[model samples]
Target: MDNIAGFIFLCGLVLVSATQPQDEILNNFQQVTKLSHLGLEFADFFQNVTLSDISLADSRAPNEEDLLCLRDLTLFSNALKERKLWALKMIDAWGSIPSGILTGNRHNLGNYDECLNINKDISQGVTIRGKYCFLQTSLSAMLGSDIGALGVVTRIKTATCFPASCSAAHMNLFVSQVLQKVLNLDIPSTAMGISDASCQTSASEPWDGLTIFTVVLLSLMGAIVAVFTVYDYFFCKNHNELPAIVKAFSARANSRALFRIVENTSNPNVISCLNGIRCMSLFWVVFSHEYTGRFFAANLNLFNVLPWSKLPFASFILHGFFSVDSFFFLGGLLLALIALRTMDRTKGKLNVPLMYLHRLIRIVPILAVAILVYTKLMTVVANGPLLQGFSGETACETGWYWTLLFVNNYTNVKCLGHTWYLSVDMQLFIISPVLLIALYKWGKKAAAGIFVLIVLLSGCLFATMMVNNYSMMFFQNSFSIDAMSNMYFATHTHATPWLIGFLFGYFLHLNKGKKFQLSWISVWSGWILCLAMIFTSIFALYPSTQSNTPPLTTLEESFYYTLTRVGWPLALCWVVFACMQGYGGMANSFLSSPLWQPLSRLSYSIYMWHLFIQEMNAKSSRTNSYFSDYQLMLQFWSDIGITLVVAYLLYLIIEAPIGGLDNFLRPQKKPAGVQKTSSYPIQIVSDQKVHGDGPSKLKETETIAQTISE
Candidate 1:
């Protein structure tokens, strides 16, 4: 009897595997069942099933065996089965299981459009259309792969076509029943699931409340911009009788301000090198983000990133975080220069409240607009499997208020996580008046005290890292949330660079007009040292990125972190000092070029919009990008081009207008007398006069400093 049953089972399997003239559904059912060893009962169940037997509208509860066969046939069809094998094959050769399995196959996105466009006729009035669904599964968990030891969940893509009427909820139920009851295969809930967000019968999604709100808000803003633009062109040009609000919001006035660049022939005090630094730093930020965004999105050769990072030249990309430190240094430097100058002009009377208010005005409006666009409009912009996961709209929804308050870094909520720098900057700005006031009152004595304080703070930072075991290098395998929170994002940990810049600013102010004639050897030595410090800070961790290198000890990490934090800024300070003192030569010429002025002016807007553009590009992509230097360079240029155009519009529409409005609203003081001619030659360029005395004369200076600081 046993021999007879075995023979019958083999014959049944052969019969099912035989080529048949049938519809795609029947064909898929045969192909899927051929791989299963479900004995005579399962084979019998599928053999009897026909196109007419499978009704999407049939509400009656299916038999356990029948439902299992149907679900398997629908999900593991010929196309999807091929994709699964492709995914495994792509990653099989990779040495690092974490890198390979974590990202899965970038090319595993099965023909989504083809599936969605399927409109097959089952019978005369009964049509069975295809619904393309994205099913995410953990290959590591399913195959019991050792990648689970890395404590990361593996999300591999599997896509398939089902009947249009079979919704995600129904599919989920079918999968669960088949796994638990029919197959008796135990799987974790997190290991496999259907993505309802990715299931699609068509491209268009029904408009929701957030979409409507975003559209209306954008439309209203556009109407306002149009009205003000027309008013500025038709009426305000000829008449000065209109309200201040009209002039402030004028697109014409704002665009003019954005494009206008004045070279200060007389301002020996102006740090012209800052323009180049700001522009280049922003470019670095954008470039790094472009590469990282691809890593987060689907990259077919993601495992290659680890090997590429080991290269010496790769430090430029890997160490891009130093660019952010450069901004912090600039912020502190500009704050000291402007505040001290303002104090000198006002004779020791500095308006602390106004300083805070001005900082808020410079940051808040455009930031609010960015947050709104991210939270409300991103969903309306694109659709893809990656979009929902990577867009960060959900984080924005809950944490936007924290971002507005400039304290999101401490909290788990991060609307735009990159804006953590803004929070740190703001906090530093808030407390700076105490130091500024002291420096103004006591002069050199206060400077000595502040230097001592910086030293103590540096010691504390070193101690904190040592105690917490924070790694010096970011985004390495050993990097953790604890390290990021304690060292990377902490305000106190960053104070060393800011304070270093502050001292440099004060030194520059004190020696503004004094011509330092250094010997040729001294100048060359300074340049070499400056270049060495900067390069070391950027590339010191290259060995750590190499495959065979051991991880740095806690003491080594702390020492490197402390040294680099201070040394990097000190190197930058030398560049600025050299440029200002006329020893910069070709370096100064490049740094102080007029070409950098426009980009420097637009840097704030670029910083705000660059990440959004990068994210949008990454998330909206239907196909996985090939990871290579050539591809990255191409994407970088594309991202930067889009960023510049958007940043220009944002600057004209928001940043410039708000700045003008701020100037208009502030109570203007009449000129006291001819501005006291100090040894330092300061140039002021605006619609207002440069030589005008009192607070009014400081407007142009204030605006210039604000641009640098932002």
Candidate 2:
């Protein structure tokens, strides 16, 4: 025991000593080296000086003799300690320091042979201040060179012992153009800060090797993912088999799991109001897409003011299409409610395969038809040849593959434009069933924790953006768009926002179970708060004060970019709360209208096909194609009109067929009585078909299975 204690003490002592101050080590070593240099003339001079006499300024006359003596003393002192030697070298390489400051003396003789002659002169012995001033200027220049050394120089007019004088920009260009070709890091030119001027004009030269590798790698990965996605979308689906878990929850003792919510029609006005909001949210999405390219432009005239054009409130109004956020929030809430109803009806298994299938059937048909027309028909009409424009930029078009495959965001770059949002929405929906299943199993606490984690992930993403010099990471079309596109796909950053929306929906659902007394005071206060958040989100999302940079004004940007990105979605839950509070009025009347029904029914289809129509219309000569490079943009509105008709037709044909097929497969039987509360124990069975991995062990699997059996 004593020996072990001794060993531990020795280890602790050694660890402490290792971390001791560097100055103590230097001081101890100097004693031995300084003793040997006592006899040397230069060393004698340095040794004679008391510790208090050390200073930057020269104490001697302005001749070369004094300068030589100073140099000799410096060399002798440097030789006494390794740390001193390094420090002296750093001073010299970084440009000189004041001798007076080091030695604690007040010599003012500034005319030294080695130092550059500036206008300042010190006839008296060199002062510490003068020496410090010279050191400051020299150090600044040295730092500039140090930074420069990191780059390459086309021409070397002079050379120095310190390499910082070399051009850093040139060195970076050489590394990118030459070294990277051999290394294959796939480092983007944007990441390296490479300029266009230094690179060669030829297409081959501009690409370097990294770009080509990136394109090939991404294409390969995308193809692999597509294979899995297509399989999951098609063959693995069993709308008829609706999971045992879902069946357990949806059914009463008499019925089954996975049931749909039948909105309370007790108050027609309230239902109407909620429906109206749904339609408005859909319109907001469409308008948001249309306005995105217009209002953000600094040069455009808006409301006759372009503060960027001296237009004040006009820009603000245009920016009000901030409604895209509302759409997102509304969509999440509705989906969550549906999931809740489904979970409650079914025992615990929601049919994920059927969910994906429903989405695929609804989105694909229109997209496929659109892709064919744009790629085949449009190409032949414009290029005067079929399949001629099927490669490169000419191949850019709205398509079914992205929506059908739940990869809308992934293919946004390939689509004409303004398609990323639609893609992101659909992608969110594709994964919703899986999320709902988790929510059903784990409950609210786990969902909230996941949401918080997602928000933190978004924070880290924002931090990355700040570190990378505010390079756009969202789907904005700009010089930084390429960088944005690359980083946006990082699941850690992008997918978190959707999770945030989901949690808000879940939270609202949890709250709805509790009843609160509705007083005049509370109702009015709720109204005020709802209006405030709406306006706050409006100002927050679209600050028209400035335009060259930052999506919002300084104040609004903080709230919009930092707060509202998450807050606005949560704020949207209050709309439902408000409608529920009061059953009748203007809000209810507006919502109950026939206008709301068609839009709500077609919202998903509209979101899917809107961009395709826009792109096609932009290609039309009648829309004044020459007036806008975005020929597909004017066509977007017209396409929306055409697509609505087409999508409605598809809903009747394509979507209805699959929905009907699922209904037929799982035909409703006679209503049964409620089962015992303990009968349906929640059991989660991993979809091996989806996970395509090993089995998960669970306690009481058989009992849980029997409980959920149809």
Candidate 3:
């Protein structure tokens, strides 16, 4: 017993010597250990627990639930010792403090250079702020705990280290993941400031190798496309004329043609209100995107705006998800309308390949140009933490296939990320022809049967989500992205909007220009019902704004999400249906006015270019981010203005060419008995299907060769 006691005393002396004479660090280490065992041995460890530097009299203690969390099982305790020992070793090797550590602010992780088999060649550092986040947030849980915690996380995100081959961001991810696996503890090595974390940096050339190759290839292709297009547009008009580049883009030369193009595209025979609705919807989408930009980064004050996100019904800003459904509805409506018109013109013949080809050609050229701009040109002009090696831009270096094939959403490797919508829309369009053909061939009963099946399937999917208690607030939570990207963004989960829109389209086709006799009560009732649905769908979350309100159950949230999607689009269908039948009154006039003509005309281009602008803006400047209506509004308008100018330029260069080619070069065949089917002159349309590989909407198109006489 004396020998054992002697050995235990020696162990204590060794531990005391190893920890140095710093009671502060050891005290903090003990606090972490106490926290780990708090739930299991609360009474025994309570006296030992200390919150490091945190002692808030104004702040309440963490609730029993938070205090009793499944902790890291001394995740930080050993971490503190390992780091202290590593520092001592580094000091011994250098005979002084390590480089760039300044002895603090950013903790150095160079000693762990190869800790996770990462082959890391960067000097990594971890920010000290997030270590206090859980404590700070736990104290403020009832009165907006989201603020400081979120900002700490985001601010911490900005501390990046430059590296060769693998980026600091990648290195950090590797270390955190590998260490967690090795240690059997769910802890971030990056957050711990040990392995792969960096306060040190080195410049990496993004324009090296593959970046250079892709850029040169794109430039050569651009020149060729430009030369061919110039010859086609100008030389075709005057067979022996030398093409002028200036003349190609001059507003004076193309103003009449541009107006003529606009006139040709505009469906004047239909109520102008549809154009108004489309323009408004697209503008709202852009607006919402701008406001939500802070959510993308951890350095921003995201939780400051959590109230807005949590507002439930009144969070029109966060409710951009539903606006996307509006596009699916619009896409289905237009696709059905166009398909029915074509089938009627073709005498029951459906050309699947032609339909697919038309949609593809209309979108691909401009989309390819945009992708090249991001992968090639954008790289030349832009390099920031978010752009150089950290952002989604890097993905485009090799992710073009999943992008072009429109399977990026499903593949989880999006090139543009925004183009997933086009892929989905294309897929839907391809499938849509089959369904429409069946309806066209077999009449109302077939359409009804398909519609019923779609409704049932959508209900089943929603029910599944409910049974599983899947979250509806994809943007509101940090962990929601995986589920959002996989399930919410995919075509399968979101097919409801398209199906609903198709029903509206078929109904409209069947009742084309037919007069309906309606009593005052019915018309009023229809308007009231439509307005009620629109408002309810958008505003139902309002009850959630009150902190006092009860939290929604899994069943309630599931129903709300499912119903919100169906309801928003259904209301829109009614608005269009009523407007078409001349019941919309001033609302119709406002929606269909020529004022919306210019905005709607450029909507597709705006959707394509806005995100790139946002990406550049996000990484180029670093500032303390704050959240407020003023700040969001400032960003919203500024983004719209810049996005508009860029959209016009992209349209002039990339988008306009496709329309110009079809309009000027394609042979106009006036079929003996029927007019040409309406062609949608679009390069890209709506962020509903394509934005973030999540959602974007659509616009109507008319084939360029057929001038609108409507």
Candidate 1 is scored at a TM of 0.80
Q: For candidate 1, write residues 226-291 as lDDT tens digits.
A: 798898888775534556677667777666655667664536776677777766676777778777
Which number leads on TM-score? Answer: 1
Steric collisions counted per model = 0, 71, 30
Instruction: Please name the candidate that would achieve the greatest lDDT relative to the true structure.
Output: 1
Every candidate's lDDT: 0.64, 0.39, 0.53
Q: By TM-score, rank the candidates, best first.
A: 1, 3, 2
User: What TM-score does each of the candidates earn?
Assistant: 0.80, 0.48, 0.67
Tens-place lDDT per residue, model 3, 273-357, is 6667777777677767776665544233444555656655236776666667877777777667656765676576765655555
Candidate 2, backbone clash total: 71
Model 2 agreement with the true structure over 1-710: per-residue lDDT tens digits: 12212212222232233476878645533432332210122223434454334422325333553343344334434443343432233223211111211111111112222121111212354311111111101111222333232122111011001111112342233334332333344334333332222211101124435445544643453454345434534644564554432222121210111112234353311223445664565555554454443332211122222232224333333444345455555445545644564466576666665555444443454455444444444432332101123332343443545543545455544443334444556666766767777787788767876777776866776666555544331223222654445444433444543575567657655664455568777777766777786677555334334555554323333334546556555555555566655523465556555445445545544554554444443322211112122532453456668878755544443333333334333435535674322221111110000000000000011122122222
Model 2, residue 387: distance off in Å is: 15
> Higher TM-score: candidate 2 or 3?
3
